[model samples]
Target chain A: MTAQPDQNTAKARTFISVDAMGGDQGPAAVVAGCLISAKANDEIAFILHGPEATLSPLVSKHPILAERTTIRDAVGIVTMEDKPSQVVRTGKDTSMWSAIESVRSGEASVAVSCGNTGALMALSMIRLRKLPGVNRPAIAVLYPSSNAQGFNVMLDVGADIRADADDLLRYALMGASYARNGLNVDTPRIGLLNVGTEEHKGRTELKEAYDLIRKQEQKAGFEFVGFVEGGDISGSKADVIVTDGFTGNIAIKTGEGTASLIGRRLKEAFKYSLLSQLASLLAYTSLMRLQKKIDPRRVNGGVFLGLNGTVVKSHGSADATGVSAAIKLAAQLVENGFNDKLAARVAAILPTEESPQE
Target chain B: MTAQPDQNTAKARTFISVDAMGGDQGPAAVVAGCLISAKANDEIAFILHGPEATLSPLVSKHPILAERTTIRDAVGIVTMEDKPSQVVRTGKDTSMWSAIESVRSGEASVAVSCGNTGALMALSMIRLRKLPGVNRPAIAVLYPSSNAQGFNVMLDVGADIRADADDLLRYALMGASYARNGLNVDTPRIGLLNVGTEEHKGRTELKEAYDLIRKQEQKAGFEFVGFVEGGDISGSKADVIVTDGFTGNIAIKTGEGTASLIGRRLKEAFKYSLLSQLASLLAYTSLMRLQKKIDPRRVNGGVFLGLNGTVVKSHGSADATGVSAAIKLAAQLVENGFNDKLAARVAAILPTEESPQE
Candidate 1:
């Protein structure tokens, strides 16, 4: 558990710690994703965690991954049904745990897992711990949007169901930092999500968070857009949308489900008649362009913020495309030194009881 | 206000109370909507509430509404910015108040408003009052879905920001009843909205509500599909999705935003190239069909559940089409005696302190 020598030197290849056992597609998909990442970016390497006997063959199958990937032995697996508390106590021997340990031990720049979200977060908190001023860590996802950047950063999408006013303020700060470092948005506009955009609407905590976020806007290096409605999540109103995990999780899932439904209906629309079928054939490329613009797999990773090290939780049901996209995101974050910047940003404006602002 | 004699006999026309002010498009849009509804249904009549000088001319312009509509003068208006508490105290002279009074006086089968949601709900609760056993009233909206009925009923969508275990249980009961009476589902399936579908997932209150809703499933005559995620709101997994107002409101708005974004992207895709434009022209009918299916205006009303009388809150910025859709829903609910049936269904399954269920 001691810190390993920092293999990720300034000019050296970036190493990503990946859990290859827990994904729905198994080690093969993980290895395939790793090979895809290695082929696409020569600077990326992976420390694959799982049963060596199971993963070694998969890694060997991909000649491209042979030199770029290392298989680490782990005996256990954290099932989807495993409680986070139970995993924290007994999951030390699991691939998910080992993957996070690599980042904690400084052997890898970031960690990626397509396992149980709660367990991965629990393990990340216990292993790497939280940043100095952070009371609770959050999971930030890049939601497809109509903004110029094509996506918006929304957090805490299921790390914890409840977040008080201070936790919300911290999410705004962390989310803004992620947008700047990860999404490349300078002076990111931070919006506190509520039922309505009116200052008088929404819960008491939201109003309190509004004032707190506004006060720290200048020091935190972000713009406060006052309060935003749920519809503004995908609109161009803000680059970073912050809310408690309970509402954030529901909003993100609801958005995904709605998009999926529309996609299905669009397909159905094209098959209704012979003329429509011919039209679909003529507009195939255009339809593909639209589909690519809103595809959920293109933005698959949910970055866990406030932790000492970066951890990206891929969807449990993600395929190779999703896993590859997550790895690409992890590499991008590592290259940008997202963790260090986020830590500094949060610590700089963190409110204190003795401070005059309070 | 005294109760007017019931003109709505078994064979008589159904009278609808309309708030002719407070909409974004003003009273013109309200009168246009009334004309649309009057022309569509011969068995419907309206009591329009607004300033006499303003509404009389608008109603007179529509020959179809001349005999079907009655104008009631009210001096004041409820601007969207007015606080719900303030409206409750000084809103007696407003059109929104007068419209609710029509329902309270038994002159109208239902009340319809395209005004401030909080003000409408506050006024509805104060004038119409909650049902005998209902503690907090909830607003239920029909969400576009993949179900056979083409939509699912989701409740507590911005009625109030909070709902405890007991209140959530009531929402489940009322939502199920709505699916049966309003949507005409034989035996509606109810699902508790949670971050995850697992038994171990979500808040403590959700778990408690889960057990309570389960106990009444058989007696309440609805199937309890335990612990549905936000994705299920638009999926075919359940017919009724229940959650607290804060989460529900955000989820619905998020869905609308996502759908609207996709629609905009689709339009942009059609305009990307000459070939795509030709394809769009060729597939106009099919695309129109798809547009009509997912159009927000088609399912525009948010029905206030747990109230003694039926009150439908149309979107504040709803156009004539949206307003007409709301009126259609109100007329359908009145024809089916939805409020009385809802009350009876709730009272029948309501658990009492002395009851064995408690």
Candidate 2:
């Protein structure tokens, strides 16, 4: 059935292409997330990609999404086990490919997926292509931080296993731009992630990138905070933290794991005795507030930067809340015209082929 | 005055060489830690390395240490800003150098330092030297984990920045041995840290190291779990986590930062309202239990592996509790004869120059 043209549609709604089949919770969670977004936002819509037989019924269950959702059928599925190289060659009929195709076709402003990260990245690169002057595309995520903004932008979480000096410079510019538009920070400060804050520490490549990122501070409209250790990732030292994919991927995951472990232990502590049980009941509201402050589900999406179009990779096991968070992030980026601004920001300071040297 | 030869010392006490002047809290904390350890364990002794004028007074204040501690008069102190190269060339009189020298001269079974990590590692390498068949030395730290043992062993935290296939295999062997002898684990399980558990994912060096590590599983007396993600670092998936120094450093620091942030937020949450404050009082014991479970100070020491002598690098800002934890770890390793066992473990599985192939 065709989606009805609602009154909000006439105002140029931002369309988010979502893959409905790949998440561990399946299509129902994706549809529920869309309903949550649709109920909260009138200027957003979704083009859901999956088997019509499955997604149509799920969308029908949510009356709010009936006017804002469109289903596209695809037979193939990209499981967590699917190899990215194999998916690139033979994933034409997959829902993930179809979801990205909507963004490539200019029908959607951004694409959201809970599929295999490697497969999703491979598909996005092949479909959307990298923006000008971006040697390598990076995945940027918002981390829970003690900054005034309550978050910090860190890049190259797992886009590729490696990044060089030029790639890091591009990440700094693009990440700073993201902080400006997406996070709305004026003159975002950038910090290169290293083992120590010392000038002569870390590997040779990090030392080389240190000078490169610092040189572009004035021209890029950002402050260079020199080097930062992993402790600074959640501190108020910088608005944007840049690092190679290998280190970034491990850092974020370690943060996630540590937070989860503390959360679990807190629950157990509250159940230890009768007094603790009553204390937990009395402190439930405050504990919930503390939980919301560090909730990973609240910051669920990892935005793939340096691509022609915006792509938000939701956690593979994300529940309805996580999916909704990802959708909200995608909507915000689209509303702010983040991709176009990021492209302009990179092009402005990028060295030309004639004078590659800074 | 000379230290009295106590009954415990007559029974061959394990002497720990301690650098007292370099910590942020100065020698007072070091002396306090020795007092704590001396009161707790009768078979432990210390060779306090620093300017005698500063340490003598500090040691005098702790009666328990009067019979168990000997002050070594080293004139120079290695500040955190001192370069490793500079310290190695002219650090003969530095407390850190003197600490390592005590271990080298066969007076102390292990050395514990709260000095510059680079300087400590450099001096340890110079004085203790690498064991036969060991290429690059690694720093092994105990991470709070969900394992039955309450901790996991992770290596190469920041000793060196690079690890090739052979180096990774060595880390696997060394980390596994540390888990067994230090943590009292039988047939410790080893996991190579990567961005993903998938065999096809991560760098080529990792894939090669995976096979090389797997080849030594039976011979090394450990179970190789193939690959593990960052989340598994705190999970019960493996007892020993192996990684390059750069990633390991970032992971551990990220864990520390996140834990610290959660702790600060929890305090604020408890102070949000009067009822919450009262509830926090009731939950004080339980919350403290949870806090003690994840306290970084409880696991404050990073052990230097692959060297002829064992060295524990305590946190620079460690207080009495932290320093005591480091001393306890050093005492345990010395009691277990960890260095000799680790060297033997490496010599058994290490590829010989005559037959370098697996």
The TM-score of candidate 1 is 0.96
**How well does chain A score by TM in each candidate?**
0.96, 0.97
What TM-score would every model get versus the actual structure? 0.96, 0.97
Which CAPRI level is candidate 1?
high
Flag clash pairs in model 1: none
Candidate 2, residues A165-229, lDDT tens digits: the string is 88998999999988997789999999999998989888888899998888778878999999998
Q: Estimate, for each residue in A1-358, the C-alpha lDDT of model 1 and write its tens digit.
A: 1112344445578889999978888878888888888889988888889999988788887677876677789989998888999999988899999999999898899999999999999999999999988899999999988999999999999999999988999999999989998889999999999988889888889988988888888888899998888899999999999999999999999999999999999999999999999999989999999988888878889999999999999988888888999999999999999999999888887554238464
Residue A161 alpha-carbon offset, candidate 2, angstroms: 0.2
CA shift of B117, model 2, Å? 0.7
- lDDT of each structure? 0.90, 0.90
TM-score of candidate 2 on Cα atoms, chains taken together: 0.97
RMSD of each candidate relative to the true structure: 2.8, 1.8
